[model samples]
Target: MQLFAFGLNHQTAPLAVREQVAFNVDGIENALRDLVENGAAKEATILSTCNRMELYCNAAKPEHAIDWLAEYHKLPRQELEPYLYTLPRDLAVKHSFRVASGLDSMVLGEPQILGQMKQAVRQAEQAGTMGILLHKLFQNTFSVAKQVRTETEIGANLVSMAAAAVRLAERIFPSIEEQNVLFIGAGEMIELNAVYFAARNPKRITVANRTLERAQTLARQYNGHAITLSDLPEQLAQNDIIVTCTASQLPILGKGMVERALKARRHKPLFIVDLAVPRDVETEVSELNDVFLYTVDDIAEVVKDGLEARQGAVKEAEVIIESGVSDFLHWMESRDVVPTIRALRENAEHSRRQELEKAVRLLAKGESPEKVLEAMSRGLTNKFLHAPTHALNQAHGKDRDNFLDVARRLHHLHNDE
Candidate 1:
């Protein structure tokens, strides 16, 4: 099967396009089943993050998969063509290796993409869309990622999104120690941001999640209290800084809600960072007076602050990925020849069985043992050589010479004759 990886990312597509195509974690299983059920691919796995939405699949035609992506997102093919990138065979293998290695991230050498990829694999498995091809691809992907991380200095001085969020908060407020920090959602991003902000020993930390138990679990780690999404209205105006990232399909913090918060605080400047894909805070929230709002796309610029030091690591990382790609492609090539190998073995077995049966009948008829064994050996030899001899006789000029060379190599013949 032809392996392909196709989609758009932070490099090929802008945040506007990325968000439009981003898959909700809750809906990925159905999307994967749609891909296989619709004949778009034989095997598929989707990697959707705040920065990228890539679909890797085993298919005969990569174009079919690309069309599936456009149709699934309800976008015209022409609109997505400009931002889409399709990598076939070896290129797809290399791209998968690079992505899992963090060489393709908006934040250089970030570790979060690897976890996101693992989640994608799990979702595909649950959907029953992950076949042997994808299973082997991901297994190699995780191995290569581990090698890249362990063998190189790629992750050194990494500027993670969490760290960037804290840096942005620092810019707005003189001292994190003096500001009250409110974090929305208890997911990985929120947990990470909580860790960074907690380091500064903020005045108070509050985690608001869809489930209070999850929020409470994360809150207990930092000696903070937990609240549900419903508490936002009464508690919103009390915090000086808010960093929100949740899986909610709709915006959790609306313009009117924040406007009331601003009025309650008497127009004190409020810093807000919305790291969710659909965005927990409304876009209109940015238009409010005395409010500084940053989304995942907005933080891309901030994350680039220390990227120069990591450039050297990127070259090293690419070399590791190249080695990985070569190994994986070799494995795929071996798999491709499986049918040929099985057919060859089956043909040989049939010839041997036919010759043995004749020899057994001759021995049962009381023929000389030596004579029967000699005849069977001759029959087996003739059967093995017949096909090659016939082909050689039929060949002309270059074809004849090429067949002769292959026959010689197959039989381990010397050129002395």
Candidate 2:
């Protein structure tokens, strides 16, 4: 089986297409198990984030794995095919290294994707879908990532997605200190945004999540209050800034909900940043007057503010990635010859055993020991040379020249010798 990677990311597909294929954190293990059990792959790991849904697999037929992705998500093959990228062997290795190093991220040099990839690998391991090939690939990938981060400034002056959300909010409001902030979700992204926004010292911070306990835990960090998602309708109108990132498959805040909230607040302006893949907020809510809504994609431009400063580091990172890819491919090539190397050793041992047995029989028959030793040495020599000598005698045209060259090289024979 060959190493293969196929996926659609923020660069290849818009949020609408991405969300359709995005796997939630809870479903990753099952999805990985199904991919392997269904004969699509021998090994598999999935990296599903707000910006990308990637499957890394060791499979004989990569097309089968591609088809499996569409089938698993209930999307037509034709529909998903346009946005998908299929990388095989060396390309797969290079892609994995680049992704782990943050070279392939939508936000150049963002560090979060490395953690996300590690989480994906952990999930694959838990599901028993991580085979030797994938495990080695990720191990090398993480090593390369560490090398890049250490040797270059790719991660310096980073404007993360959370920071970008705050920047966008600053553009809408005169001052963050004057506005009340509502964070919807207790996930990492929401926590990040809350941290950034909290530093600006919003008037009041409230965390709303499906579970009150999780919300309460996050809210306590900011000296704020917590509420369940069910309290959103009643409490929504009180907040001017809403930041949401959740794992729910459906939109948590629909257009009707936002419209009512706006009405209750007497048409006060509301700024929302949704970092969720399937979207915690409805798309139509962007159309409402006095409402500014931003999805994960919308944060891309804002996050590019410091990209030019990191272009030099990108070159350094690419140099590191290319070296990594070359090393990994060489290792893979060496593995491909293992069986042949083993067979050659086994064949030589068999011939030696046969010759030794004959030598023992000759000694038992009272033949001279010295003569029997010479005979055994000669037998072993002939057995070792038999295959190459026979092949040389039978070969014709270019095959004869090729065999001669291989024989010369194998025995270290010079032309003069």
Candidate 3:
């Protein structure tokens, strides 16, 4: 099977299209197993983030994997086709390196994609779908990411999505210190945003998650209150600023929920950042007069704060990634020759064993040790030269010249010698 990757990312698809294919964290292992079990791939690892849904696989027919993706998501093949990008072999290797190094992220040089990729690899491992090719690819991928981070200023002055969310909130509110901040979901994204918002000393901070324990764990870190997702409706009205990123398959904050919250707050403006891919807030919520709803895509502009400075390091990072890709491809190419090399060694060993047995018999028959040793050495030399000599003798014209050249090279011979 060949190494290949195919998927749609934020660069090629809008948030709406991306969300349709987004694999929830809980179902990632199942998705990976299905991809391999369905024969679309020999091995597969899926990297699903807020910005992209990509599958890197070792497969004979990558198109079948693409078809599987659309089928799995229940999206028409035609509908998903426009945004899809397929990379083969070397291109796939380079793309993986670029992605892991954060060159391919919506927010350039952002470090979060690296962690997300590592998570994808872990999920693939848990699913038992990670085979040698993908394992090697990601191993090189992460190594390249580390090299880039160390050799370049790609991560310096990085404006993360969480920081960007806080910046957007600042625009909406005069003072974060006075506004009540409620974070929906206690995942990494929420925790990140919490760090940024908490630093501002918001009047009240709350974390809402599917499980209260997880919520409480995060809440206690910021000296905030915790609530289960079921408490959102009642708690929604109390917060002036809301940041949400959850793995829920459906919109958690519907238009009606926001409308009720707005009414309870006497139509005071509510700033909401929905960072989830399968959005936590309904699109219609953006239409509400008193509600300012921002999706992950909407945060892109704000996240460009240090983009100019980071761009300078991109070329440096690309150089490192390209070198990594070359090294990985070379390793793959060497692997391709391994079976041939093994067979060659095994064949030579068989010849040696046969000759040694004969030598033993002659010695047992009272031949001198010195004579036996010389005979055995001659036998080994003849056995090693026989195939090439026979092939060179049989060859004619250009083939003869090719065989002669190969024989000389194989034995490291020179015309002078």
Candidate 4:
């Protein structure tokens, strides 16, 4: 099977296109099963994060897997083809290593992508779609990531999306300590943002989710309060900063909701960061007066400031990743030879067993042990050499010379004379 990876990421596609093909946590298992059961791939792993949606697969033809993505997402193939990147074999292996090492992330050396990848692998495994190739690929991928993290300073001076959100909020307001912070959703991104925002010791932090129990769980971690989504209307105006990242397909906060909140706050400037892909806050909410709204893409500029400092670490990380890629590819090549090695050993064992059985029968029939042993040895040697000797005899000129060299090397013989 051939290894391949194809997808669109933060660099290749904007949030609009990326969100269109994003996979939900609940749908991943079915999607992976569909990819493998329908013959698009022998094994597959779908890594769908806020910034990217990549399918790493083992297939004879990548087109089938690519087509499956478009069809699965119900998008026109032509519309999505322009932004998609397809990497095959070595390129795929290299890309997987780099991605896991944080080399391919928008925020240079952010470590969140590595955890996101681990979650994707777990999903694939639970779906029962993970096979030998992808299993080995991710195993190597994780090892490379760990090596890069330990050997290089790639994660140094990193600016995560959560950190960027906090930075942006600080720019708008003097100090987060004086402002009440509102975090929507209890997902990984929201949890991380909560941690960063909590570090500033926001006056009052509130986690609002569809489920109060889940929101309460995250809220307690930061010594914050928890509320249901229904509480946003009454509680929205109370907070000066809001960071939202939810899986809701529809907008959680609309323009009217924010307008009312603004009126309640008496036109006090409110800072909002929408970290969701489809967007928890409506796009029209940005047009509201006295509101500073930022999306995930809007944080890109803030994330770039530390890029120059980490440039040197990138080179070091790449060196480690390259070494890892070479090792993984070598392992893959060795796996390819397993069948041949097994067959060769099996063939030799069969020949030896046949000769041993004949020798045993001769001894049982009262033949001398020395003679039987000699005959068996002769028979085994002939059986082992027959193929090579026949090929050598049939060879002529250049072919014969090449065959003779192969034989000499096979037997470790030297023409010292």
Choose the strongest candidate by lDDT: 2
Weakest 10 consecutive residues of candidate 1 by summed lDDT: 10-19
Q: Write the per-residue lDDT of candidate 1 for residues 1-417, one digit (tens) a residue.
A: 878998888889877778788899999999999999999899999998888899999887778888888898899999999998989888988999999999999898999999999999999999998998899999999999999999888888898999998898899889999999999998898888888999999999999988999999999999999999999999999999999988787899999999999999999999998888877888899999999999888888888877888888888888888988888888999999999999999999999999999999999999999999999999999999898889999999999999989989988999985
lDDT of 3: 0.92
* Worst-scoring 10-residue span by lDDT in model 2: 187-196
TM-score of each: 0.96, 0.95, 0.97, 0.95
In candidate 1, which residue ranges exceed 4 Å CA deviation? none
Candidate 3, after superposition: displacement of residue 123 in Å? 1.2
Each prediction's total of clashing residue pairs, residues at least 3 apart in sequence or on different chains, is 0, 0, 0, 0
**lDDT winner, 1 or 4:** 4
The per-prediction CA RMSD against the true structure, in angstroms, equals: 1.5, 1.9, 1.4, 1.8
Runs in model 2 lying further than 4 Å from the true structure: 356-375
Question: In lDDT terms, how accurate is model 4?
Answer: 0.92
Q: Cα miss at 20, model 4 (Å)?
A: 0.7
CA lDDT of every candidate: 0.91, 0.94, 0.92, 0.92
Of the two candidates 1 and 2, the one with more favorable TM-score, higher being better, is 1
Q: Looking at model 3, report the run of 10 residues with the lowest lDDT sum.
A: 408-417
lDDT of 2 by residue, 216-331 (tens): 99999999999999999999999999999999999999999999999999999999998999999989999999999999998888899889988899999999999999998888
